[model samples]
Target chain A: MSTNKIDPTKWVDKYSDYLFNYTIVRVNDREIANDLISETFLAGLKSMKNFKGEASERTWLISILKRKIIDHYRRINSKKGQAEVRIKYSDDSNEGDWLEEQAPDRLDMTAEDIMENEELGLAIIRCMENLPEKQAKIFKMKTIEGFDTEAICNEFNITPSNLWVIIHRARTTLAQCLEKNWF
Target chain B: MSKFKSIFVDCSKAGNCCDKAQYNEASLPEKVKMLVHLALCKPCRKYSNKNTKLTKLIKDCDLKTCTEEEKQAWKEKIKQEIALKDRG
Candidate 1:
């Protein structure tokens, strides 16, 4: 286990882009992503003595950045109540179901088609940004990272019901947003 | 109770069913209720189908990354901060 300190000077030029790209995708906020990068470097510097060269510098930095992202979400989740207000349906008769008039037209595109449509991709990101911060983070963890329900509940210190409610709210908002913007 | 009573659900319940199905968290009764609702309500069915597709789209979409200029600026900022800390 080599104990040489990672030179702080070379970090910016070598790994900044990789780390920035990684964080921007997960957080979808450039300012926040940049902040995480700064935090990662500072944390890394403090723990440089513990670096054993087991993972490449990039991997180590990414691991730190990942923790920072999780911490960011955890901090946000702790402050907010678990039971978010339910979204109101257009019509009271149907309880909380979407009104027929507001129901989105069926999307006909395939996964391949969506992948190629840069406009649609941007639209999706915009919709995600519109979601409440905690919902957006939870949605990303579940869908993008494919974290299981138990893992997510454990991480957020939320119950299964709370997790499901958040997921439902997030999906409904995303579907409605995409339908309005993309379809 | 009749099987009809057990299986029947309103549109709102159907919406919950759709969301639960996305996560594979719906119970057997909820699943049955959703299926019945979808069969009868075209709009709810469309909602369920689209909701599922949206999850798939996000899972599949290749997200955009930071630009080179942005990356460079971030790196510069980090370097400046670390240098200041060292000076202090």
Candidate 2:
């Protein structure tokens, strides 16, 4: 009888970044990605009654987002064979030479590598959620956003020394959380 | 004794410096003091190594966040929809 509850109110704060990163890498267009996420949220709300609460809210939302992404591709694909043009290897001239061009580019990531990095990103976000709210915010602003120490201090109304202490604590906690699986 | 005290830092200061160094924010003198402490302290060295690895992993993940304006728009949509459902 126990099930995870869903809270629409907290969705933006809790999972928006995770979902955004997941989406942008796939869609590769900021505007399209934003639209897809909006649609996903709307769809999730409309289907709220069907949710059994068996899965976590995030997992459920992600399932809906995946559907939206697929639908987007399907829509574009159905429009005048636009998808066909994206297949560069389909051209007849490169018949024998295509395989050579398929060799992995040194600068690009393999699909598996990209997948692992995505998983790692999600893991870090989950660990960050475990931190106190202020600490998590400060850590993200400093480490992820690359804000200057003085700038952050002025925003948070804290001194440089206080900011460093917070950063030190946040880093230590994050390291411990990731030690077993990632470190 | 006073000169030695000025040159050497304790573990806590070393940890702070290590964290700052992860962000490339530590001054050269601060880094030198941290290294001196790390040389003599086993646990601190371990902490430093783990901290460095943590920084690298985070950088490699390349996580991105939604802008506040976009997040606000989503939140507004969700709120309006919720209000409509409640009324209906």
Q: Write the per-residue lDDT of candidate 2 for residues A1-183, one digit (tens) a residue.
A: 539898899888888888888898889999999999999999999998888988889899999999999999888878965434433566687776766587777577778888898889988988888889889888999999999998999999999999999999899899988998998
Give residue A133's lDDT in candidate 2 (0 to 100): 82
Output DockQ, candidate 2: 0.82
lDDT of model 1 at residue A142? 78
List, for all models, the DockQ compared with the true complex: 0.16, 0.82
Q: Enumerate the chain B TM-scores of all models.
A: 0.65, 0.94
lDDT of 1 at A175: 84
Per-model TM-score, in order, reads: 0.49, 0.89
lDDT of 2 by residue, B1-88 (tens): 9987887999999999999999998999999999999999999999999999999899988988777799999999999999999999
**Looking at model 2 chain B, which ten-residue stretch has the lowest summed lDDT?**
B59-68
Tell me what TM-score chain A of model 1 achieves.
0.46
The clash count of every prediction, one per candidate, is: 0, 0
Q: Which ranges in model 1 have alpha carbons more than 4 Å from their true place?
A: A1-119, B27-29, B62-88
